[model samples]
Target: MKLTREEITAALVGLLGADSVIVEPVRMDPYLREPRKRFHQPAAAIALPHDVPALQALARWANEHRVPLIPQGGNTGLVGGQVPLGENEVVVSLVRLDKVRALNAEAGHMTLEAGVVLETAQSLAADAGALFPLYLASQGSARIGGVLSSNAGGVQVLAYGNARELCLGVEAVLADGRLYQGLGSLRKDNTGYDLKDLLIGAEGTLGFITAATLKLFPMPQGHETALCSVNSPEAALALFYDMRRRAAGTLTAFEIIPAFGLDIQLRHRMLDRDPTAGPSPWYCLLEISRPAGGPEGTLMAALEAAFESGGVDDAVIAESLEERARMWAFREQMSECQSREGASIKHDVSVPIAAVPELIARGSEAAVNLLPGIRPCPFGHMGDGNIHFNFSQPVDADPKAFMAGAEPIHAAIYEIVVGLGGSVSAEHGIGQLKTGLLASVKDPVALQMMAAIKAALDPHGILNPGKLLPPSP
Candidate 1:
């Protein structure tokens, strides 16, 4: 026997009070709509649990009834993970759980509630004379819970690391409503199977991340930012090696961008002025953080060496904070600028650091061959090997038609990426969008292990029902 929609709604209202549960269709729009505007299925209700106990009660009931629950934070996830996949599902928004539970700037750790905004966490760290380096374009709205759940990697991953590395522990509600109190500031804990790591990147399939203990760092005194022109990806790679040799640990960020990226940004009025030194085939936006007593001119000296080696053709080092911001603006605006051109197909993939040039070259050629005049805008964390391989539709092509024919293009790109010993997904987790893709690319034994873990933690299949894992055969 199953509960009807009205029964589900009334039960939720009873458990969490009428104010916390939303059953009206119009009022559910904000929680229902995801960033990509894909996956538009109606939810039975939107559950806004006011605290940890309320959330636990809701999860307990959902599990017992075998009702699916989708854990959402900020609704900024690019994939449809935060949105409902079926009408019977309930979206459990964690927005009201926002809080700063504890902060120890000197100890290099802070415990933050899942709903705390990423930007707010950064500010809290900065105010305490520390820095939270996990930055993203959507940081303003992307909450800590989803950030960790997705295991997000931002620009500075070259030095600091991704969300998984920055996090020390997590506090989550299991599928059966049992709280996993794993929060801590410990740098070493060899007790067991590392449950914190599992929940951090689990995509809410096993548990709901209610809060986390995140690692922080001492604020850098300043940053040396530059946008350098390179003849090719190979040249950029060589320069990257040289920069690493020179700066080593101080090298915080090294991003790559194509000329197509700049042209579109300027054409679409996304930037007030061009941020590059001059016209070039490609560009590398590199930055070095200076410590309290660190030497200056590190970036300039590295570039001079790169210029002598012909790895860098031209460069512009930021003489002021404004110039530095413009350089970063050029890098951060890469994804949004592509939309102005028209419909675009995007892949978040990664290869070995040394294989990135080959990945770009082969990927671009394959895309052009498939669709003539299709502009390839392959750019992103070049230092970390994750290239946001995006292709803008052919000029004057129908957006609908171009999008309809995306399967062949995706197949072409993924084939090349896998052939080069790369991953199909790098930073973005296997949300609803990539579950099938994950099944195809992932190792058979690995999939079995994941299934076993899911079965153990969520036997009723109530937690994020249709996400991360592919359908059972």
Candidate 2:
């Protein structure tokens, strides 16, 4: 038998007390709203547990009643994992559990509760003379648990690795309320089955991440930033190889932005001033971080060599911190600026690093062929082979009608991405948005393995139901 909304609320209030529960539909708006605003289904209730014990109790209660629980932190997920699908599900928010449990800068580790905001964690590390190295656009609102659950990748991935690599250990509350205390700061643990890796990118399906021990890095003295003009994606690829040879581990970011991206941003007046070297068909935002007491001008020398060899046409190096901020603002604002243009079809897809040029070339050609007037805005972390392949609707076209025509555009781009040995959902995990697509594209045996794991860890199907893994074939 299914529980009514009133009965569910009563049970939740009894377990968590009335103060920690929000049953009013109007009051749950913030928790229901996600960053992308794609999935906006209502949840039955929002439960804010104040501590670990309360969280465990709520998990156990949900498990017993067969109630679906969506684990949310900061409500900043680009995918809809933190938001709800069915009105019967309850959102378990970890915001009240924010805390910095411990820190050891010399030993390069820090323990933080799930609800602690990413920006706060970075500031805490900076105060202790270390760097967290996980930089994301939504860091101000995104939290540790959600970041780990999503296994987020940002600009510094080339040097620092993604969220999964940055994390040393995790403490989670499983579906049946059993606490898994796997928080160890050790670098090497050959212990059987890496549960931490499994939970990190599980998207809150296997367990509710409560807290984590994160690896920290020595704070960089400063970053060398530059905006370079590339004649083609081929040239960008060649320049990347040369820079990698020179900068090595010091290379932090190598983002590629198309001329169309700049045009959109400029049309929307998103940037105070143009940050590129000049008007070029494409631009590559390159950066390299130098540790304290390390030599400077490594990035400049590499760029000089590339320019002499005709790998780059021109470049502008950041002479000050303000200039550096401007260079990054141009890259980070790529997504938001698109909104002002019109309805846009977007994909966060990735391919092998070496195949990036071919992927972009072929993907753009297919998109153009699909919709003749569609404006392609392909840009992002070229160093990681992840491109935010987005297309803006025709100028002055009806957004509703343009969106209605996006089906073929999406199909064309995704087909090209897959054909080039790429993933449909790269940085963004499969939430409600891509569940069906994941099932179709994922390997059959791998899908079965995921299903088995989900059943074993969350037998009741109570944790973030209908996320990450697809149903059996």
Best-matching candidate per TM-score:
1
Residue 307's lDDT in candidate 2:
82
Residue 221 miss distance in model 1 (angstroms): 0.1
User: Highest lDDT, which number?
Assistant: 1
What value does the lDDT take at residue 3 in candidate 2?
A: 89
Model 1 Cα displacement at 140 (Å)? 0.2
| Residues 267-324, model 2: lDDT tens digits | 8888888888789999999999998998999999999999899999999999999999
Error of 1 at 48 (Å): 0.8
TM-score of each model, paired residue for residue? 0.99, 0.98
Expressed as tens digits, the lDDT of each residue in 144-223 for candidate 1 is: 99999999999999999999999999999999999999998899999989999998888889999999999999999999
Q: Which ten residues in a row have the lowest lDDT in candidate 2?
A: 464-473
CA-lDDT, candidates in order: 0.93, 0.90
After superposing candidate 1, which stretches have Cα over 4 Å from the reference?
Answer: none
Candidate 1 positional error at 253, Å: 0.6
